[model samples]
Target: MSEADLIYTETLMQRGKESYTGKEIVILGGGDGGLLWELLKEKPKQVTMLE
Candidate 1:
């Protein structure tokens, strides 16, 4: 998917926002992580890439 076309499933988005909250999130897969990394920039303390 293109950078602008990436979409997170509802559950993933909810969990990311709720459970993950302010914790660093480690993304296991690389495909979607790029886009996630960008979206997460707003909440820098809430996301990280592993692959």
Candidate 2:
């Protein structure tokens, strides 16, 4: 993963790796789909991206 992806997917959430676990996530304006890709690794309940 890229540095920005790491930051947004992990560091920015401030809960580390388990941040997205079983959670519903919505991503706004992630046109490149990088954030979606990284977030999926955490196994969130659902992920919706609008771009």
Candidate 3:
């Protein structure tokens, strides 16, 4: 991942937790689904993952 992507993800995680809002997650490109799985643990309503 690029530096910008990392920053954005960290920011998202923080905001999501603070606001207690589950995001409708979406991913583009290809890679492992580990991140999505982790997000699910945070009780996100749905993950519209595309890989």
Candidate 4:
């Protein structure tokens, strides 16, 4: 991935931190749990990822 892509990803992650804070998150089509792995970093209130 390019550096620009990495920056964009970080921006989105920060946005998620704001929007998903103190909320239950359900990630549909979380294939291979890749998204779950990223989310686990934040340690949100709750997360249920269905693949």
Give a tens-digit lDDT track for model 4, residues 5-43.
546545645754565556678878865555566666667
Q: Kindly report which residue pairs in candidate 3 clash with one another.
A: none
Q: Which candidate is the best by lDDT?
A: 2
Q: Which lDDT value does model 2 have at 33?
A: 78
Q: Model 3 off-target regions past 4 Å?
A: 1-21
- Each model's C-alpha lDDT? 0.54, 0.77, 0.59, 0.65
| Model 3, TM vs. native | 0.50
**Lowest-sum lDDT 10-residue window in model 2:** 9-18
TM-scores, all models, native as reference? 0.42, 0.69, 0.50, 0.55
RMSD, every candidate, angstroms: 4.1, 2.5, 4.6, 3.8
Cα displacement (angstroms), candidate 2, residue 30, comes to 0.7
- Write the candidate numbers in order of decreasing TM-score: 2, 4, 3, 1
- The positional error of residue 22 in candidate 3, measured at the CA in angstroms, is 3.0
- Identify the leading candidate in terms of TM-score: 2
Q: For residues 1-51, what per-residue lDDT tens digits would candidate 2 score against the true structure?
A: 678666765554565545788999998988677778878888999999899
Candidate 3 lDDT tens digits, 1-51:
566665655575574555324756666642555455456676776777676
Worst 10 residues of 4 by lDDT: 8-17
